[model samples]
Target: MKLYDFPLSGHAHRAHLFLSLIDVDFELVAVDLASGEHKKPPFLALNPFGQVPVLEDDGFIVPDSIAIMVYVAKKYGKTDWLPEDPQQAAQIQRWLSVAAGQIAYGPCAARLVTVFGADFNANEVIARAHSILTLIDAELANRDWLVTNRATIADIALYSYIVQAPEGNVDISFYHDVAKWLRQIEALPGFVPFPTSKAGLRAIS
Candidate 1:
């Protein structure tokens, strides 16, 4: 298996972490976003969206971070990463939706502004980040994992940017439960981390 990746992308980090957690033997192929490599024909052939973190298993290609997680979990993760039960699946899907929507436009977008120089209202996105973080923190107050008794793709899908939200100036110090939840994920076997950036108010080396 091969993962077309970018070093600083949370989306890429999620896929990388999940693959490592599942003990998948895969090679990382860095896509040079600085050189427009992802926008070129070769990479575009793999994913027309021209995004990093595209996965290639044998001849099979998968794109988008969430899509890649779903595919990998279904094929390799069994019940741990994604449960087959209808109710559990629905619960996982709810959080997955938050990952794609709220999490995307919130902390992820805030970080994109500072880290990538994206043209977005930083204050607005940061506020959105806190709002969702508050909700997630509340939800985690009574649970260790997001969807099930064990960690799932829902947790993996949401882990990266939330942990890195401080890099976007979204203060995580106030969300004790969220912080604990992050530590729980970190304690899992084969865990990998998203790189912390110097952008925003908080800095991590």
Candidate 2:
């Protein structure tokens, strides 16, 4: 498999991280977002939306980072990342939705403003970051994993942006449970961290 990736994208990080966790041997093809290579014909042939983290397994192309995680897990990882129970499956889907919506609009959008100079309302995104973080913090208060006894795709789905959120001026210092939860993910085997930018509201100890 060849993973077309951009180092700075948290979306890309999720795919890369999960592949590593599953011990899949794949090649990395760096996509130059700076030069708009993703929007070009060759890349667009892989994903119409021109997104990075597109996985090419043989001739099969899978777009979207979260989708890549799901595909890899279903084909290779199985019960390790996804479970059999209907309730657990539903819970995982819930967090994946949060990752796509709240986390994307909140921490991810906020970081985009600083890291990529994206035009977004920093105050609004940061506030949304906190609102979502508070909920995640509460949920994590009694558990290490997001939806199960061990780590799942749901945890991996939310891991990158939430951990890097402080870089977008979203302070995470007050979310004690969230902070501890971040540490737990870091301690996992085969864990890969998202690159932290120097900008944003870093948590103060």
Candidate 3:
């Protein structure tokens, strides 16, 4: 298996983290986003959207991080990470949608503004980040994981961006349960951290 990754991308990190946690042996192919490599023809063939963390297992391709996680879980028969129950699957899917929607426009967009200089209203995105985080904090107040008793793709989907949210100037200190949840993920076996940017360091300081 091969994963096309960019080190600084939380989206990419999500795929990488899940694969590592499952002990899947996959080769990492670095995509040089700095040099417009992701926008080029070769990479574009893998994902027309020009995104990183596209998985290539044999000749089959899986694009998007959440899609990659689902593919890996299903393909590898690691149902523990992704259960087969209908209601459980639906709940996990709900958080996955949050990860793509709120989490994207919230924490992800905020980080883009700081780390990549993307043109986005910092205040708006940071506010959105806090709003969703507030909900997540409450949801996690009585549980160790998001969906089931154990960690699932739901937790993995939300992990990357929330942990690095401070980089986007969204203060996470007040969310006590959220902070503890981040540590729980970090303590997982074969866990890999998302690389912190200089902007993230400054924001936390």
Candidate 4:
């Protein structure tokens, strides 16, 4: 398996974390997004959307971070992570949607604005995204992971961007539950640190 990714992408990090948790061995191919490589012909052939975290598994190219997580869980991980019950699977899917939808638009977008200063309305984006975080904080008030009673793909999918919310200037100090959850994720066996650069915007294209 080969993972074509930008090291600093939170979306890519989700797949990275899941692969690590499952102890899957794969080659990492760095795509220099800084040079518009993703948009170039070679990379575009792998993913037309020009996104990172494209997983090449035995000639199958899987794009989208959330989809990669689902694939890994189904193909390699224990049933506990992916679950077998339809209701449980639905709930997990709901949280994954939260990660890809609300969390991506809110906290992730805020971080991009704060760190990269991308040309978006930061205030409005943050305002809308904060509500999602508040919902997560409340939902996680008494839980260890997002779905079921233990760690799942749901947790791995959401962990990277949500934990790094501070880097985007979103105050995470008030989200005590989230902070605790972050620590728990860090303590998990086979866990790896989120990749960082000396300058936060060093990887921006």
Candidate 5:
């Protein structure tokens, strides 16, 4: 299996973390997002949308972070990553949706605007981001992980951006529950840190 990804991308990091947690042996193909390599011809052939974290297993290509997580968990990981019960699966899906929707809009989008200098209404986005964070903080006030008693793809999907919220100038100090949750995720076995600098990003690239 081959994973084409940009290290700094949280979405890509989710897949990488999942593979590591499952002890899957695969090739890491760095996509140079800094040079617009993801949009270039050869890379676009892998994913028409030109996104990172494209998983190629035996010539089968899977795009999107959620899809990759599901594939890996179902194919390689323990059943805990993806439960069998319909209610349990729906609970996991709820958090995954939160990661894709509110979390993306808040921490992820804010980070891109601040770090990559992307043109976006920071004030408006930050407002939305804080609302999401506050909601998450409250939800996590009495829980450790997102949806399950233990770690799951739902936690992995949301951890990257939420943990790095400080880098985007979104203060996480008030969210003590989130801070604690971040620590818990980090303590998980096979945990990998998200890229924090241009050099680290280049190394992953």
Candidate 6:
């Protein structure tokens, strides 16, 4: 298995984190977003969307971060991380949508501005980050995990960007439940950290 990754990308990091958490042996292929490598023909063939975190396992190809996690969980028979129960599965999928939608526009976009110098309006995205985070904080108040009693892909899906939200100028300190949840994920066996950036350090400091 190989994962096309960008070190600074939360999208890629989420996929990377899941692969590690599942104790899989996979090679990491770094994509040079700085040089437009993902946009080039070679990488575009893997994912026309020109994104990192594309997974290639033997002859099969999987694109998108959450998709990669699903593929990996199903492939490895990790039912704990992705339950098969109808209601539980639906709940997990819902949070995945939140990850792709709310998390994307919120925390992810905010961090993009600081970490990669993306052109998003920082204030707007940061505010958006807080909105979703506030909801997530409320949801987490009565539960240890999002969709079920145990850790699932939903938690993995939401972990990356929210953990680093402070870097986006979206302070997470006030969200006590969210902060505790981050620590829980971090403490998981085989957990791999999303690499912190100097920009993130400066922002939080």
Strongest candidate by TM-score: 3
* Overall local distance difference test of candidate 4: 0.83
Answer with 2 or 3, whichever has the higher TM-score: 3
Relative to the true structure, candidate 4 has a C-alpha RMSD (angstroms) of: 3.1
In model 2, the Cα lDDT at residue 123 comes to 91
Poorest stretch of ten by lDDT in candidate 5: 196-205
- lDDT per residue (tens digit) for residues 1-205 in model 6: 9999998899999999999999999999999999999999999999999998899999799999999999999999999999999999999999999999999999999888888788999889988999999999999999888988878999999999999887787888899999888999999999999887767545448
lDDT per residue (tens digit) for residues 79-195 in model 1: 878898999999999998999999999999999998999998999999999999989998999998888888899999999999988878888898999989899899999999788
Instruction: Estimate, for each residue in 1-205, the C-alpha lDDT of model 4 and write its tens digit.
Output: 9988787799988888888888899898999988999999999999999999899999999999999888878887478889989998999999998888888887788777766667767777677667887888898998888888889998888898877776665666788898888899899898978875433233441
- Which parts of model 1 are misplaced by more than 4 Å? none
| Candidate 4 vs 6: which has more lDDT | 6
lDDT of 3 by residue, 1-205 (tens): 9999999999999999999999989999999999999999999999999999899999999999999999999999988999999999999999999999999999999999999999999999999999999999999999999999999999999999999998888889999999999999999999999998878545548
Task: Output the lDDT of residue 85, model 4.
Answer: 92
RMSD of each: 1.2, 1.7, 0.9, 3.1, 3.7, 1.2
Cα lDDT for residue 28, candidate 4: 86
lDDT winner between candidates 2 and 3: 3
Residue 24 displacement in candidate 4 (angstroms): 0.7
C-alpha lDDT of all candidate models, in order: 0.91, 0.90, 0.95, 0.83, 0.85, 0.92
Ranking of all predicted structures according to lDDT, beginning with the best and ending with the worst:
3, 6, 1, 2, 5, 4
**Model 3 compared with the native: what TM-score?**
0.98
lDDT of 2 by residue, 134-197 (tens): 9999999899889989889999999899888878988788899988888888888788878766
Q: How many backbone clashes does candidate 2 have?
A: 2
- TM-score-best of 1 and 2: 1
* TM agreement with the true structure for every prediction: 0.97, 0.96, 0.98, 0.93, 0.93, 0.96
